[model samples]
Target: MDPRISKQRTALVLDQPFFGVLALRLKVVEDASCKTFWTDGESLGYNPAYLGGLNDLETRGVLAHEVLHVANGHCWRQGDRDPKLWNDACDYAINPIVLEAGMLLPKGVLVDTRFKGKSAEEIYGILAQEKRQKEKQQKQQGKGKQDGSKPDAQSWQQSASQPKQQPDSTPGGSSAPQSSNANGANTPSANPEPTATPDAAPSCGEVRQYTGDDKALKEADWKVAVLQAAKAAKMRGALPGALEAMATDAVEPVVDWRPILHRFAQESSPTDYSFAMPNRRYLHMGLYLPSLNEPAVGDAVFVRDSSGSVWDETQAQFAAEIIAVNAGVQPRRLIVMDCNTRVTQVQIFERGDAVELDLLPVRGGGGTSFVEPFERLEKEGIRPAFLVYLTDMDGPFPDEAPDYPVLWASTTPLKRARKAPFGEMVEVIC
Candidate 1:
């Protein structure tokens, strides 16, 4: 280990343990061929000359930058995309975060404020869109010249008078010129520009593509490590406010709610084997086997929180999933109940009847109360196979868990969803 790198890692450990802890996970190796610094999700590679050019603060920043690329899973995220562009997008997404931590990155590194709070995927979309648009414009210009058509006077003058912008080297050690257009248009020059030399490029570092069979395992390990680092930082009162939600998400990962909803419905439905009705296919083969029969998924109750907290779009999405699940399970009846403090509207769909969202009544703008739906179910003498409640889980709960299984499809933070008195809780991402 280089003494300077070792000293800065220690400095990070004392000041920013979250970054410091993650930084230690990457084994540092000096590579003369490396332009500056880079990480392959597991190890950090750097050129000795790069570190020697930076002061202590900038060196520490470079280390944290690489650590974040690993911690944020950027290396494993570039799937089938142009590698250079993906690297640029990842740099845009994380550079602001590094700068916000009050660490100094060497000048000329990619840092676009436009992508400050966006994820790498989101930034990639914008960059990809810009690239496509620019390519289209260039293609049109080329066609015009081939057709012997002259460019408009203003357009020709603008092109001739505009000073050529030199390509700026990204932290990834590749030359990607920063867009000078105020609108953030990243247009490449039609003619190739000279690539920046290694010595002249910024020392902000690079994130290499993670190409290994254990990508999922590595990603899961990083998530757990992030949670642990966050805990350690929190204990020392050093956790950044910007990272609080990220840490919380690490603690309770956000997953697609559709599969979870489907699983809950499937598990809660009744199943039995009947010897009276032998399997016809097996009977033809002279093998007498008991027929496995799944009873019609009995009445499924869907309770919607209509207390003005949940968005209409979220309800529509939840309703669509419920209908899809119902189609799969073929429930005998689907009872849609819109409730707040009390059950406001009820729409029941009997077996063989079309279940349509347009027919379902939407009502209620009162306080939230989970007790009303249960009370209504009891009053109607309708014992459902399962009940799915879509809410923010910011309401009063029933005194006891009901006999029937309950699945809270909550549209709140996982911490709040965990407060549900009973049943399984899955975060409903809107």
Candidate 2:
């Protein structure tokens, strides 16, 4: 090594070879005429167009929002999933945290807008009305950059990306996560939002107990409302569901998924990642990435540990967002692998299309392992450029993971991956 060689000068270095599983190197374009923030696997496109440079807090929130996407498995989760749908899920999924952290939304998208009409900056009241009241009543309270933008003392703080310290759990709740999978099935729970706000009439601070007069949007109708909003955001492009996402609802984070590693010693986060109706799991589940890009279409097949229970709706949305991101990149090929076989793959799913990818492979499994995928890829002569092996920290990995990049997304902060050589690994709670 050159005596004076700097880490910045070195193209790549790793704690474990497999840890760096991402395919695109981010690009940074900063000057007078650039547009809004967008990413290709390799780089970023910046706009000097906005004259106001971010103040430290604003900058951190914006960065946190983007980083949260990568850390949350928002990118890879979209494998063969519909892009638009998945992105819509994320905007809704991360809304609480983003708003809590102070990311402001456009003027009218807030769900409570029809009522308040932007007169009050009521923090997270729209999302968790009771929570806001409780916190305000309590009078209690509550990182920065490196890379293309410029490195600073915050460079060291980037470690804050996934803080070693656990975050505060959901307000006014017990330690137990609301529900868990039973035999590879979806466990239904009332929506994470506490079943009170979906129909927040023009009242100040009332937690409703459905009256005979109760009239809420039908589930199908609510879905349509959400879609109409997401479509309005997506057609304008640039992060898809941003407007419909409603950044005003007190983005304060809820549960941080990082604790499941040790907190649920008897159980494990599911390796089978899927979308459920929103839950309190996201705040803790957040991850921070600098950026992401599209790999060549079919260049990689995202395999799921569908052996465990799954979040059906959330998983469906995960698939959709990936499509949204990829649609922007226009990958050369796209292949989705399930435990059983490939289905409805090779083509991108357009929004509103009734997509039914084969789900057989998602079933017929009890335990977990990485072997089936090695054999699958080998059968196709496809050596993945990198792999994101999401797991629950309970299963043992292959005696050897191929010499490629792999991030171990396990429940708790990762300890040691016994085997799986060469690839970079990250522990993500499923």
Candidate 3:
């Protein structure tokens, strides 16, 4: 390891342990051929001269920037996208985060305030759209020239004599010029301004594409590493605010809940074989095989929080998912309980009964208490296959875990879901 790099890694371990834990995982190699620094989710390669150019603070920022690319799984997440553009988007998304952690990036590093708090995929879409527009404008300009539409010699000379607007050399600086339409209304110019291109933009580090078949495995490993790093930082009381939310998100990623709900329903429903009911088809073949006894899909309990905190759209989505789950699982009984401080309303849908939200009554506009639904289930002797509680997770949880599986489909921010005493929690986006 280069002495400078080694020194910075130690500094990170002491100051920012979360990033330090991830940074130390990357095997460092001093390569003069590497223009700046780069990480391929495994190793960090840097030019010694480039490392020498940056001051201590800037060098630390560059190191952290490379670690963030790996930590964020940017290398593995670039699926079928333009590699250069994806890397640029990843930089834009990571730079502000690095800056927010109180580190100073080298001059001209990619930093767009618009991309702050956005995922790399989101940033990539914005960058890709801008690139397409720029290409379209260039093509139109080329076609106009071919059509013999040329500027007058005097106008051309005057335009040529005018000083060109220097591209904003500072990171995150806006260079776009505003123009007026026929109605004299000022609007953003259709002509793409000269901003940061891959060649023009000086990145702190590059996110190299992962070319392995085990992209998912690699991504999972990084997520685990991130969690472990977070734990270590928390132990030392050094985790940054930016990293806290990010770490929580890494653990509970935003995913479609339909498939998860289906899986839970399928897994919770019991299946057995009964020797008393011998297979008739096997009996004809002189084989005494036991008959498969699949019981009716058991009761599925859905507890809705009727407290004012839960959004109407969230409730609607919850109802829609419940209906979908019921259709798929075809449960013997679908019990819908609306509760706030106590059970406000209980609607039972027996097998073959239509499950519709529009017909269901919405009740309660009071304080939240999750204990009521569980208490009611125990009192009624209802051993459901699974119970899904749709809430903001703001209320008090049951004192003890229920016998059946519990899935908390919370509409609140992910950080709030951590408060659930017992259950698998998923963020339900409206």
| lDDT to native, each model | 0.75, 0.34, 0.76
What TM-score does candidate 3 reach? Answer: 0.53
Clashes per candidate (backbone, < 3 Å): 0, 57, 0
| Candidate 2 global TM-score | 0.28
In candidate 1, what residue range of length 10 has the lowest lDDT sum? 166-175
Candidate 3 lDDT tens digits, 209-232: 877788778888988999999998
Q: What TM-score, over all chains together, does every model reach? A: 0.52, 0.28, 0.53
Most lDDT-accurate candidate:
3
Q: Which ten residues in a row have the lowest lDDT in candidate 3?
A: 166-175
lDDT of candidate 3 at residue 119, scale 0 to 100: 67
- Per-residue lDDT of 289 in model 2: 26
Clashing pairs in 1: none
- Residue-by-residue lDDT tens digits, candidate 1, 304-414: 877644555567788888788778888898898887666777888887874343446357654568898998888789899999999877678899788999999876646
Stretches of model 2 off by over 4 angstroms after superposition: 1-298, 340-361, 411-430
Name the regions of candidate 1 deviating beyond 4 angstroms.
150-203, 250-279, 282-430
Candidate 2 backbone clash number: 57
